[model samples]
Target: MPFVTVMAREAPVLVVVTWEKTVSASQTTTQKAIADEVNPGQWKVLKPRKGLQMIDFARLWQFRELLGMLALRDVKVRYKQTALGAAWAIIQPVTMMVVMSLFFGRFAKMNEQVGAVPYPIFLYAALLPWTFFASSVTASTNSMVVNSRMLTKIFFPRLIVPFAATGTPLVDYAMAFIVLLALMVWYSVSLSWQLLLLPALVALTIISAMGVGLILAAVTVRFRDFRYLVPFMIQVWFFITPVIYPNKMVPENWQWLIQLNPMCGIIEAFRASVLGTAINWSSLGMSTVVAVVGMAIGLLYFNQAQRKFADVI
Candidate 1:
C-alpha cells in the first residue's frame, strides 16, 4: 500500500509514527541488512516514461482507486440536472429501437432478413452494443476537455480520464439490458448457457470504445478539430455497422469488410446469445482480434501524447 501510494503521488508518504520495538536489536540489524541488499537506494527517482514503455500500467493499477472514484463521479454527474435522470439510458436506446422497428420493420420489412425474430428485438440487441460504444466514446472524447481544470491541477493517469469515461456508460448498458430482457420475454426468446459470456462481450465493447476514445481524447488536446471529427465518424460508423439489419444483409463477397468493423462480431454474438441465433465463430474471432490490436494502438498513441496534455490543454 505504501509503495503504491508513493507511486501515485510520485513521492513518499512522510508520516510520523511511534516505532514499537517488537523484535530485539539483533533482528532489526539483520532485517536492515537484507533490505539494504535488496534495495541499495532508500528511494528511487521518478522520471517520465520513455518509448513504448510510456504506458506504466503498473502505475495505473496503483492509481486504480482514482479510476473508480472518477468513474463513479462521472456516473453521478452525468444525469445530475437531467429530469429523466438514469431513465435516459433506457430511453435513448429504446426510442431508437422503436423508430427502427416501425420504420425499418414495417416499411422496410427488415424482420424477414433475420427470419421470425421481431425487428424491435433484433434491432434492440444490436443497438445495445452500438449505443454503448457511441456513448462511451463521446464521453471519453469530451472527458479530458471538460475536466481541463482537473487535468492542469492533478496528475493521475491521463488514460484514467478516458478509462473512467468508458466505464460510466456501462451503467447505461445494464439499465438498457432490462429492456433486452423484456424484449426476450415478448418474443419468447429463451436464454442459453452462452449468456454467461455477456461479460466478455461487455469487455470487448469496453476495449473497442476505450481504445478509440483514448486516441481521440489525447489527439483532441492537440487538435480541437477532432471534436467535430468524432461525431461524424460515429455517424458514418452507425450506417456501416449492422445495427438496423443483420450481418447477412451484406453481400458474401464483401463480408470480409464486416470483420474489419470490431462491433460487427460483438453485436452479432450479443443477438445470438439473446435470440438463440447462430453464432458466427469466424466473425467473433476477427472482432476479438480487432479489439485487442486496436486497443494496443490507442494506448500507445495516448501514452505518447499524454506528456504534453497539461501544457497543451
Candidate 2:
C-alpha cells in the first residue's frame, strides 16, 4: 500500500512530513490517491493527528500548581496593606448581622419568623454561603481581566482563571467558619453529623459561582459593561435572597418559587446543616438542577468565547 502524509498548518507552513511509498502496485493504487484517502483517517504515514483539543481538562489538571499559585496570589492581594487582613471577612458579615439583628430581628419582629432558631444564629448560618457566593462571583468575574497577561502568553486551561479566583473566598470561608463554630458553641447549638456535608455545600456554591463567573468573564472581555454590572447584580441579589430573614417568612405555597433562585437552596442547606433546621428537599432538588444547568450553559459559552478572548482583550 502507498504511504500517506497529512499536514496541519495554522500559519506559515513548512512541510511537516515527507514519506516514501515502498509497497507494490497490487497492494495499493497511486501514492497521491492513497494519500488522499488515508491522510485524514487511518494508515497515515506521519504521526496520528492529535487534532485541536476540546476542553483540555487534562491541561486544567496539569495546571493545578498554577491554580494554587493564583489562589494564593488572590489572598495576598486582597489583604495586602490592609490593617485588618482576613478579619475583614468577619467584619462585613458581623456588621450585616448587627444591622439585621436591629432592623429585622428587633424592629420588624422576625425572631420567631422562621422557627425556634435564634435570629442571629439563623442569619449567620445563611451568611456563610452568601458571603462565599458573593465574594467568589465578584472575584471570578474579574479573573480574566486580572490574568490577561497570562491568558495571552500561556497555554493553560482558561477556566482555571475563574476557578482559581474563587479560592480566596474559600479561605475566608474557613476562617469565618471558625467564628461560626464559636457562635454555635455560644448559642448552645449542637453540631450534627450532617455538618460533614459542608464540603458538598461548598462544592455546589463553587460550581454555581463558576457558572456565573465564566459567563461574565467571557462577556467582560468584549463588552466591558460587565465590570459595572457585577456589583449592581450582587447588591440586588443580596436583597432578593433571604440572608437576613428566613425563607419561611415567605408563604408556604410560594416557597418553591423562592427556591427557584439557586442560592436559596444553598443558603437553606447551609442553615439546615449547621443550625439543624428543617431541610426543604424540593428546594434543594430544584437548586441542584438549576446549578447544573447553569454550569453546562456557562461552560459551553465560555469555551466558545475563549477562542476570541485573546483577540478581543
Q: Which candidate tops TM-score?
A: 1
* Alpha-carbon runs more than 4 Å astray in model 1: 1-50
lDDT of 1 at 142: 88
Query: Per-residue lDDT tens digits of candidate 2, residues 1-313?
Result: 6544344222112221211222233246555566775332223233432434245354465567998998988888888999988899788878887888888888988886867788888888888899899988988888899889988897777888888999999998888888889889999999898798789889999888888988998899888789999999998998778888777677888876787788998888889999875677788888889888898888878877887788888
Which portions of model 2 miss their true places by more than 4 Å? 1-53
- Count of backbone clashes for each model? 0, 0
Per-residue lDDT for 15-72 in model 1, tens only?
1110112123346667787777432222233566444444555557658898889889
Steric clash pairs (candidate 2): none
Model 1: per-residue Cα lDDT at residue 224: 86
In candidate 1, how many Å is residue 94 off?
1.2
Assess each prediction's global lDDT (C-alpha) against the native. 0.82, 0.79
